[model samples]
Target: MRRLLVPLVLVLSVGGSLGGCGWAGRHAETSKPDVFQLQGYVSVGGAASGVPGTPCLAPTSVPDVVAGATVRAADADGKVIAVSSLDSGVLAQASDGFRCNFAFRMKNLSGSRPSYQILVGDRPAQTFQTRELTEGKPAVVTVTASS
Candidate 1:
């Protein structure tokens, strides 16, 4: 009985020591910077006179921009709201230092246009409305909300 107790205690001590080493090892690993980000971009596209319509607006300082491109978003009914474009410079002022704004632009694609409600994650940040788009020029839309 005495011998068994001695070995059991030694085994337990070694196990605990190994567990601590594993934890330290994990912390030593280099990882990406943790940050809050908003990113979106256009997928569909068109062209004119054998030339591509502005494939996408270059990202700038606008809240409605995404990776220097324009894209669109929609609701279930498919109502357009606002145009989004990439504006990385503007988002640099986000209250949350780690936050960003990236989205696809949206023009009045349907008969009825929807109102805009900017979001960050699931939280509503702002709201706005856009006028009807008469020119075929695509409208920009940005979504700085996390998916």
Candidate 2:
């Protein structure tokens, strides 16, 4: 019983260490644990995917912007563990505190890509360029303005 207890204790300790948000650094992208990602979007050192929605300056034909980006450790049942909102642009890594990014697109009347800013958590993130939509060229204006 004593020997069995020692092994069980060691195994439990190792498993616990491999659990929780601490594992975020390793499985940040592989598992959904503390993971969230949207398509058409780009993130650094993590997961990058496309989000469903038109640029901020989308035309009437454009639909609502849907942000689908995140990463989190979840259960086998697909239950959420930790949810983190993600933005597809430039990612800033903090050396001390926390930093976040956000953006919103507005359909531009001009054909040129419009520069805009997005607010996150009451704070405005840096400016990002996106398709504003011009006259009629393609069925839907497609732009990939990166800052």
Candidate 3:
């Protein structure tokens, strides 16, 4: 009886340790793809520029102008998946002239989508393939807005 009890205790101990390994938790984590971050720049051009043919006049006010504006990401079916807001704007020199460029970042975006449609503010959506965003590189998008 003592010998039998010793083996049974050993078996139960081994089984309990394996159960505590948390296989289910690890599987749940592996089942989901890693989330990606989307970083972009919003360039306000046309009449929205404080000064035509030059950089914005009041650089500080650029942030106020774009405040509360949102950046949205939609799947092929036009389902809105994630959203972010413009961070802040700064005057940047451009070939045509100068423009107010605002930077933004959207986190926790799934890379499972075949493609994405990005819409900044009220501008039209721009389509991008999944590879463009998930290639282990920073996906910098430039959105042009007009007044």
| Strongest candidate by lDDT | 3
Q: Model 2, stretches more than 4 Å misplaced?
A: 22-147
* RMSD versus native structure for model 1: 17.6
Per-residue lDDT value at 55 in model 3 = 36
lDDT of 1 at 147: 25
lDDT for every model?
0.37, 0.32, 0.66
- The sequence of per-residue lDDT tens digits that candidate 1 reaches over residues 1-147 is 999999999999987896775543455558522221223322212111122222333223332334544333444444433445544322223233223323343433343434334333222234334232322233333333222
Segments in model 1 whose C-alpha atoms lie over 4 Å from true places? 1-66, 79-85, 101-147
Question: For residues 1-147, what per-residue lDDT tens digits would candidate 3 score against the true structure?
Answer: 998999999999987886686443455464644568776666654324344334343244334347457888899988999888876566766677566766677787887778778877555677777776777444445544433
Q: Which structure among the candidates has the greatest TM-score? A: 3
Model 3 is weakest, by summed lDDT over 10 consecutive residues, at 55-64
Q: RMSD per prediction, one decimal?
A: 17.6, 18.5, 8.3
Model 3: how far residue 23 lies from native, Å? 12
For model 3 the local lDDT of residue 85 reads 84
Alpha carbon lDDT at 11, candidate 1:
93
The digit string of per-residue lDDT tens for model 2 on 1-147 reads 998999999998887877754673574467533222211222122212233232222222212222443323223343433343434333334343222223322231222324323322222233333332122211111222222
Give the CA lDDT, 0 to 100, for residue 104 in model 1. Answer: 42
